[model samples]
Target: MAITEIPKGFKTLLPDEANKREKILTSMERVIKLWGYNPLFPPTVEFLSTFKAVDEKFEEIAFKVVDRETGKLMAVRPDFTPQVARIVASSFKDEAPPFRFYYKGKVFRDVEGERETYQIGFELIGVNEPEADAEIVSVVVNILENLGLKSFQIDIGNSEFIDGVIEELQIPSPTTFIKLLSSKDISGIELFMEEHHISGERREKILTLLDLYGREETLDKAAQIFQNEQSLSAVKRLKEILEILKSYGFESKVIFDLSERKGMKYHTGITYEVFHPLLGCSLASGGRYDQLLKKFGRDLPATGIAVNVDSLQLLLERKGIFKEEKKDFYIIDLKKERKLAYEIAKALREKGFSVARDIIKRSIEESVKTAFGKGYRYVIVLNRELKTPHHIYLSSEKHFPLDDKNLIESILTAVKEEK
Candidate 1:
């Protein structure tokens, strides 16, 4: 038998990374909950058909297995929105409108080989209004700000804005147009139009307009080239959304990208991606998927956003924002004064401090050295033979008698004040 090697492009998170990741995730969940978005946990594996209903491309990268007894094909979920939609359509059909739910979990996607990705995202279902969009956008912005991330931009785009323009052109197999738009391949789009014998002043205008890819001004430029009512309506919607974002005071962080078109197959209206100076890719991506609920037998509108927690941690680390604080410990000598030591340790523990009592019957020097080496700040020494009471010793200072009971309170109070 041969010994197997560890997998590539995948690594375990060590103590430091795990601690930072946990803190960021906790903050994200806290903000999400504060925004009235309840948490939901869905299974990591589901039937293959559940995901295929959203996009066939998912099947290519999905890890699949066959049930031994039932012989049903199952897949590890590559995304959460599909499963979330499945849950809502199945269980919350009779529930009221505007269901806001948040989730944080691992999603498996086999990009090259089997790789597991973790993401934290939220879904706002049964609400099509711009207020819901603003709420979702604002929630994400708030989470990022709360994480202490600076120098980030949230680029907003509308799928319908581009789709409406292409629909009016009646370009057969608009996949070419979509690809060219997504890749910012202006030459390819022009060449394709030429091959299709699309020669006119409007064609020249559209080709020139593809370069309009940033800021609110781009919307006006796109509106000029797009004479189709559907395209114009999409432009109007984009402007309205931009206005909403501005009203939220996130206008500076918000930028418009007309050529930005990822996740467009499932997304019906507004789509957004968050970028930062440190990340090579977007830290988070999401938008409205109005048609997702319809697949689950409910014809309701919905939208969502998903933050890549792993990527977010990377950004935070690169920005030097997520440094872990040293753990504080209170060490007690249980052997010297059993009763007093237990009482002091119990008191410290009751105060919500991490208390590590030294049970070893070692010399005072050995205990003090051990506690100091182990990163304990305060060491309480109890001398049973001495006439005086227990004395608390600071690692920075020498031992002293603390005769007063209020001294313990004073020490804790001082520590709290320092923090």
Candidate 2:
């Protein structure tokens, strides 16, 4: 392998990709903030003990490191939701209910065939009502809508329903059975059910879960088969969430999935996974984890969603949804008016323009060529002795005077009125 080659599943985002990612993050952050969620930054590294209560699967894929000072093992964060729960449990133990927080950052994991990725997510804490779950669903739906994602489906399910069935039937090693449900293995499920002596009208209902996925009527089918209170309650909760989503006009995008196993042990309530028809993997996934915070110290009911931005970025690129950032300013100072150029650049920056100064000892033609090649929309040439028409705006090939009086204001207006 090359000496500088990064490890498998690690990525190095170049400028254009990073810029696009920043734009995507900004778009998501704006919507999250508008929904009354404040930003919360979790630590990149935590003592391994912090994850003791989380799903055992996280430990297997965690990037572990040794702490030099303490001689203890620490792990780079493999997920953000657990850290959010940790913070709510310990950091804000005394705080009141309904903590709304959003975060966007990198998470490193050792999972094979999966890239270390950037995640944008939000957590709503201290609410156990179905409205809270519905609210988070609406929030993510709004986020995807803002990003112009129309060809996607949010598969919503409640793990409690499935777990309750297992508990009621005394199913052994529930994970194995859950896997069968996830894959819709009708024969495998039948064989497992037979081996476990699980045969009855309920067996038929268990098989029914494999096909209980579709429009709103899918929930009605589930309700008819679920006789147990826990399963019945799940159907009711789903109905409530669906009704709330209907009120938000996002119900059309939801598909009721009764067989989706919860992503983690912490997820105790409604769970959802977002999928795109064009992508083989999930584009986003999250759910309610009411018991996770209790492990950290606080007992709070919370729900959240994490959008797989890397996957979404790729999908957006394929869809050609992003445009080049071409409004940046390029100032070419052929005459050594370094200080004046700096002042102009600063002024443009203060007015919310990204300015780049040409510092190479090149001719005016070459510098302007470089600026245009780099997709800079506005270019200005500086003069040694300031005079009327000494500078030029190359975007329109029109020369504008560089008078000292009202220079910044005139230049700002000369660029463009549109931001």
Candidate that would win on lDDT: 2
- Report clash pairs, candidate 1: none
lDDT of 2 by residue, 126-236 (tens): 999989988888888888889888888888988978877777767797889998887878889889988888888668777777787888898788777766788889889
Q: What TM-score fits each model?
A: 0.87, 0.90
Q: What is the number of backbone collisions in each predicted candidate, taken in the order shown? A: 0, 0
lDDT of 2: 0.83
Q: On a 0 to 1 TM-score scale, where does candidate 1 land against the true structure? A: 0.87
